[model samples]
Target: MKVQEIREIIKLVDQSNINEFVYENEGTKIKLKKTETVTVIQPTASPDVVQGNAAVEVKPAAPATPKAVEAAAPAAAVSERENLHKITSPMVGTFYQSPAPDSPAYVKAGDKVTADSIVCIVEAMKLFNEIEAEVSGEIVEVLIKEGQLVEYGQPLFLVKPE
Candidate 1:
């Protein structure tokens, strides 16, 4: 789904009483859950009582500043450029560093790897895709954190070519 559509869905969810919702189209699926609860009470008592209740839960909405969003865009672009030689995700999914919860990671930040080294796993559609390095190099940085949902074409690591 488009990002704008997702944003609208989120807004609707924030203002409603729904707890959870899921939508799937083609091969993509999105699930959203309300992380906090908001309660509104009817005023059956005096006006002073309603005013006191209103003062109980007066939290301001926090919105992202335009300048902060703009700054993040360039930082993301620069990181992509720096990891141009590293292999990126072939599809969108949750990235995992190990095969299982108890297993060791396929590679570490400083590990040297070849074109065929399995650097990580990207889980999509209940399948674990073993991501490999496309070039021989030492891993300079791991761009994604464990259990993070990544987008297609997003950089997963940085490799200094050997």
Candidate 2:
């Protein structure tokens, strides 16, 4: 299913009282579960009521000025990154930079990739999935390290699209 469809499903499940939901189509499977939280309130002794007609004055907080936020990096660098496309993981799994140990990485920074190019692998449930660079571009960055646990929709690489 599409990412938008998955987002919609998540929204529906979150808004409803359902605790768990699973969906599978073709070879793709998605499972979503909501964590339950329990809140406990303890009874406390009530404060003694004031028996005097004492006058009380309340002071309001002074108005504060908002500080100007400074940019962390140069504007050119930020603009360059904004033009890049991100290749993200399709499932929660371990990220592999290569098909196997001792093997050269599938792709790295400065490498050109097509939409069908296999850029990395994500192993989930013992199944090694070949992740493709869906956008034709020159890979500008590898966001995740090898053997790292990656979350679904997490960015793995940044590409300068052709």
Candidate 3:
């Protein structure tokens, strides 16, 4: 199965009342299960796995509840900050704020950046990938600290678009 298909499946399951869903095609198997706080997707075997094409675990920030619904009203204000663009890790890896440990960080909060500006590096399987801002903006926050393990598509920085 393709990654996009898997993503669609996840979206369907998340929105539905189903607790578990399993799919198999050829030699690949995909299993999705929803817990109180997380939705996990893993392969029964070694094919079409998400994380490095191996295994993947997706966690929701919080579970759905009445209290959470009430809290969401305040959270909606966060959308006011939606103008901030997120700089996300392209792959699962250790996030490095600098090219090297002794060097200064590529960018920090309040730093200005344009599309293609190298904001940080994600080291996966010994390969260092320089992450870019992809938007013209001022860095508003660094979501993750240096040398932290970041997952694919995880937000690393928030930028206030210029």
Off by over 4 Å in 3: 1-77
- What is the alpha-carbon lDDT of model 3 when measured against the actual structure? 0.74
Error of 3 at 82 (Å): 2.4
User: Candidate 3, TM-score vs. the true structure?
Assistant: 0.58
Off by over 4 Å in 2: 1-71
Q: Name every residue pair that clashes in candidate 3.
A: none
- Cα displacement (angstroms), candidate 1, residue 148, comes to 0.5
* Model 1 Cα lDDT, one tens digit per residue, 15-108: 7665455566677677655544445454454322134223222233334355445464687776655555757886667999999999998888
The lDDT for every candidate, in the order shown, is 0.72, 0.76, 0.74
On TM-score, the candidate that comes out on top is 2
What local lDDT score does residue 32 receive in model 3, on the 0 to 100 scale?
63
TM-scores, each model vs. reference: 0.52, 0.60, 0.58
Indicate whether candidate 1 or candidate 2 has the larger TM-score.
2
Point out the worst 10-residue segment of candidate 2 by lDDT: 53-62
On lDDT, the candidate that comes out on top is 2
Alpha carbon deviation, residue 13, candidate 2 (Å): 6.7
